[model samples]
Target: MKFFLTKSYKLFWVLIPLVFMYGLFNKEHSLMVNIHATYFVINHLDFAGLIVIFFGLFGLAYWLMDIFNKKLISWMTAYHVFISIFGLLILLVFYDEVENLEIDYAFKQTLILLMLITAGVTVAVQLLFPINLIVSFLRKKKH
Candidate 1:
């Protein structure tokens, strides 16, 4: 249990798979979506969501490459960059649809809360995983 919680655990590699599965199994009534119709609506940002899933798959491939070639990690940064770029592009293309979204006040609040919590968890996981990698590298050098 402690090992799983620490920055040194290989379990950190689970991030990519989790991201992939989250995207693949994304649901209409998912806890992640406060508005059930958000993705189903015409001109909605479904393609952007698909891009995010592809980025996750790429991240997993990047990790596998890193296992064989350590330099790949230094060359390829976070996979979220791809997702962020495509997400912004999609938002730009669907600006009117997004702006005209009719989510209720309570649903909007819930969405905001969920977004905050997810952001916090993502940050913590990112921080912890890097610490694990750094500590491992330093220990190797010291030895």
Candidate 2:
């Protein structure tokens, strides 16, 4: 786990497969919407693009992690990566439920609110990057 986060290229390699898997997912969803008429009204591209953007930002962050410093607070990377992924999973799951569950509108609205909050938090957590950088740059010399 430590190596995964600290080694940017290794993590990037991991991310590539995830991105491709997501691409296949989107392709399947696209087929459903087009041929099967699945009634899944979610903009398939937007969701796919969301995943792409997520990976893109992570890749950039990890690369910067390499450039700015080889080390990071292990817990910080763990929290950021896990929570961001968790939030994205929640978003995708709730989106599917809200769209396809055939539940009450009120329940769906609640789900939407949850989605909104999760997204806000997911985005907010990225603020840690700059925070980490500030601390990194501001540190006094060991000499």
Candidate 3:
């Protein structure tokens, strides 16, 4: 259990999955489609909101790549957490425009907020929990 909380393990299971989920959401939202159709360009808020979402998705992909390459060391995880927070902040900053989309905006906002919170919580757990207990225990030879 504790071994799973280590930087490498957490990077694989937690951070990677979170970033993948972010990418999934970004694709599902079809932000590019909205922009190309001009639905997001009609207003300043919408344009800015769409831009933020794109940046967030970009950051998420970058982070995921880092994890996939086994490059997310402990310090890197800290950076990744900040990036995730920034992504969340971008969404929060544009909440008003996001809430105005044609779909059930309220539901969308709630889902995004929940995902952001869960990502944050997972990072916290990865950092705070005993990460290498299992590995350490296994390394101890029996008498």
Candidate 4:
């Protein structure tokens, strides 16, 4: 119910190394994260590899919120974290070696569509961070 900046950022910081390590040691060896403009390509639709960049941004966001001494809106932070973790889990559970394996065409298309939608939602959620930062910078600090 109540999420704080410390919890929000710590969640991401803890995930960063795990994601980096996963991307590093992944057997597919095809996980390419182009954080260049913030896009990822994995085999076919391998998306979990992007978690490193995603989580790092979150950590940075939370840290910035703290630096600005802004009080986090608990529900907002909780929803953001929940959506992200849900998206991540969906990719990890169903997308492994998907391109290599011969699956049904309809199923593949549906899955791809689902993945894309989820990714879009996740990215959209990140907009909250910069907005949060700007608002925090502008408004008076909370007690």
In lDDT terms, which candidate is top? Answer: 4
Query: Candidates sorted by lDDT, descending order?
Result: 4, 2, 3, 1
TM-score of each: 0.32, 0.65, 0.27, 0.70
**Residue ranges of candidate 2 with Cα displaced over 4 Å:** 8-13, 27-42, 140-143
List candidate 1 stretches off by more than 4 Å.
Answer: 1-101, 140-143
Better of 1 and 2 by lDDT: 2
lDDT for model 1 comes to 0.41
Clashing pairs in 3: none
The residue-by-residue lDDT of candidate 3 on 68-89, one tens digit each, is 4422234444444444445444
Q: Which model is ahead, 2 or 4, in terms of TM-score? A: 4
For model 1, what is the error of residue 94's alpha carbon versus the real structure, in angstroms, after optimal superposition? 14
Off by over 4 Å in 3: 1-101, 128-130, 133-139
Ranking by TM-score: 4, 2, 1, 3
Pairs of colliding residues, candidate 2: none
Which ranges in model 4 have alpha carbons more than 4 Å from their true place? 1-6, 31-50, 88-96
Report, for all candidates in order, the number of backbone clashes.
0, 0, 0, 0
TM-score of 4: 0.70
**What is the alpha-carbon lDDT for the whole of candidate 4?**
0.65
Error of 4 at 67 (Å): 4.2
